[model samples]
Target: PPRVRECVGPPLSAMAVQSTPVMLGAAGLCFYAASRTFTSPLVPSAAGAVPTPHLRAGSAAISADAPSTFSGVVPAVGLLAAAAAVAGGRAATSTTMRRAAKVKKKGVRVVEGKEIPWNIFSPKAPYEGKVIANHKHPHTLTEDTGDANWETSHVTFDHGGKVPYIEGQSIGVIAPGPDKKGETPAKIRLYSIASSAVGDNETSKTVSLCVKRVVEVDGKHANREVGEDKPDKAGTHFPDSKVYRGVCSNHICDVNVGDDVLITGPTGAEMLLPEDPEANIIMLATGTG
Candidate 1:
């Protein structure tokens, strides 16, 4: 049978192009030294000897008539070059991705001599705040508009001297489990802090939020018959989707003085007060903002 020669030049060259400089240098040196040994007059190739198919690393094939010393060296060098090429390729890809993507700031940051916390309590691990006070504001509406009138409440939560917050910062409220889609521990809702650093009662062990109960009729069920509405096992009636309640806002507004609420972070720095005591700030707000 006639001897067959296989070439792996294309794939190996592509790999070399994608590999890092160190890997390319190492592979080049190995091949260069091996080429010198193969071309030397001192080495001889046995012609007409029974050809034995030999496969080396990187899918390269070498003639079996080559000297035994060179045969062993080729595969060893091939393995080293192949390994280096793979590792260098991966490293190059990773570096390119990092260079092209923007990295988010991590860890704590200091501002105005005060250390600010970032992601201290994430959604996965939120802090438990106790409802200390939940009261409806009497001056929310002055008109005779019944359901149309705004219903706002000032709610306070006891942090037990654990959660420290400044004015303009916001706390994320995670409503109780099993949402409409049966998803446990519903999504988080961020509400602005309504109190200063000293808190509503002048103590730092608490945080407060001004929330307005969201009540809107869903147009989807507006065409349904009046008698079609039914009540769940909890005795809560679904009246033609009559009331689409805001999960977090309604939960906080309806809480008693001892219920526990899931809280995440006292985050936000854009609206922080200036360090100067005489900064003279202007006040402008509307609705439950």
Candidate 2:
């Protein structure tokens, strides 16, 4: 995971020179790292090199930087060939997003296939506090979870006009801007859903989130105390629980009613539930380390 953490702007000049190629970002096109390793970036800065002449054909989108491992001219020809392959269709230039927003104000038909990128819906938002209606349940109802297990914290939202999702997705909780005692943005984490679309038929679009508190253990011992007793009087019947020594979990655990929090998601992940009626499932998780 640490190896994949990187940035790709402003060319690097701190390493030994090899067959490195500089990468440039185009506003309209999608860009992603190919995960090529053992070697670093292919692009290098041509800070002092003289500018080359610009040339244009009738309808070709010229590439300014040469892709590493290959010569300048191949990518250009490849682009041309790809364009020709999708000449009539929008694949060469357009995506379903265009059909939904720009081209058709009436609305585009849901094609019922293929996955889109996570950034398309733009879930990123700033955390604004909200009031927790319950005395014990600190998490504000981000949406009606529709889970029968939790009626106290349940909430309802007309999610995206209709619920937008695929199974096995998770949501990211962006905790409130650091507590009054601290001065940093709250860390974000993910939670998976445990509900099935059983009675969710007509109107109320809903999703469930496994909401819990944050526990921070800054001291030597990472575990909670061996044993302790606490009482609960919220009438909700959930026990008075102590955080097990985690930073984010601790803060989350202390949430009071009427608190504001930020949430984003229904983002897809690699794990998926089996679709075949006869398929078997095996879940395995190790002990709490």
Candidate 3:
């Protein structure tokens, strides 16, 4: 773990280096803002850890000339420190943004007739014409096979989009549904991107989704129709004949060769892969929650 110990040092030092401006700015701003406002509404901030000052009727002109009597220094100092931390984090983010912009935006070169989205958001290319060609592998149900499902059921998307990704990314499949009420632009569901940049040309851009059908409850599907309709029960969301069944996997499960479907983004940071490639990944999941 010495390497880990070593890894932590520079960043901490950089943060300390970056804190100078932020800490000063915070202290100055707090002092400025409070100076204008009177003590009557000098609200105690939201930490709820401390009580606001109890002031006398005229509080001696409320001057900090008497440093002994002034108690605002503690909160002011804490606020300054928090501001510094935030600024340091922001600086790192800005640096990363610049780097990403500088790197080549990798993408799938369009091969056939279909367009594919390779952005960090939607990773999968929609099945162009109906009847998806190679679906021999629906979704790997390899429960405990010590298998890497990252490359399972992998289908390559035509390059026109970049698949630059880390270990854990979430993408949404843009599955268009019936144009019923409130059902346009399609709904998108987040799927964790399984593959890393393994340099494999074929399946590198492809992402995997581990999902199960959220079927309509028996009572729900069995509900009776309203107005001049059957007395049998039906599911939620009226116009039950059709509805907004999620965008990606649900559509994926039912994909036939060449179905004209839409796909959206890979938007999520929750399960982002660790920056340290040497870091061991420990995933804990309870029934795909």
Candidate 4:
């Protein structure tokens, strides 16, 4: 009998191992062909054909070293483009973070030409502003303990387009003439700003204050001297008392439209509005704060 060989299939793992190398070889050949096609010069239509003198003269000579040069240069160009894209992305991210930091530091949204004014007019050299309007509220309460009939006034001043202020800041009002202490120049009283940066009428030239007349009764007063205080017939300790008005409050409240008043300072930074539009704000105020 002739020698017989048994037919047996190779194991699955062995088949996979054999196929992998073949596939790898095919892939490598394909990659090399693709690279050569990209980086190598165009081949002439006919092989072993000599170029005519006129054709050679008209066309630039192809250098033998050019294909190697292109192979290196193409990868370098691609890498440069990728680097630039990454750098641009990082720069954009950095800029966004810087803007956010600025907003957080300011605590308020920034408005165009609306920064908190510092000493626009100092107490020494106060701005002489004309009272544009002094409107009285119908029912207003004073900060004093007494339930006195006190009035709140919305006093607007025209600074001839010089004074600029934002909301939540304060300005100083110099009460004319001598103080109660007999000082020659009256002291400057700071009042919270009630209007927006653009004044009452949206003009960039004016500012307004909400002032409540300060008044005190005999019972609330610390001093026991010099006031007509009469007890009720029932001998109750509470008594009818006199009302003493504040010099600055009275001056501001009594001011009429077109009257000139001395003003100083557009100060205070703690109450300034934040620059971010989406920021949450909570305000706690009482009695013309």
- Worst ten in a row by lDDT for model 3: 227-236
Candidate 1 residue 234 Cα shift, in angstroms, is 18
3 or 4: which has the higher lDDT?
Answer: 4
lDDT of 4 by residue, 175-215 (tens): 98466676656899999887788887777788877777655
TM-score of each: 0.53, 0.37, 0.38, 0.50
RMSD of 3: 21.4
Q: What is the lDDT of candidate 4?
A: 0.63
What tens-digit string does per-residue lDDT give for candidate 2 at 174-229?
A: 65445333535555666654334321333234444434332322334333343332
Ranking by lDDT: 1, 4, 3, 2
Candidate 3 lDDT over 1-289, as tens digits, reads 3554434355666666556567677768677556633444433345563545665444533333323332565666677677777877787777678768676544432224322334533334432322333243434342423221111233323223343444555555555653224465555655565444432334554434455433222233322233322211111232443222333444555444444444455445456555567999887876441
lDDT of 2 at 124: 53
Q: Residue-wise lDDT of candidate 1 within 1-289, one digit each (tens)?
A: 9999987554665555566566665867677666655442222236455544433323333435534556556776777777776777677787668757655445355667677765567799899989885343332322324552146767788888777777767889999945555567888888888878878777788888877766555544232244454432123344645555556666776677788999888788878888789899997877773
Which runs of model 1 end up more than 4 angstroms from their true locations?
A: 1-107, 112-114, 134-144, 218-241
Which ranges in model 3 have alpha carbons more than 4 Å from their true place? 1-161, 179-181, 198-203, 219-248
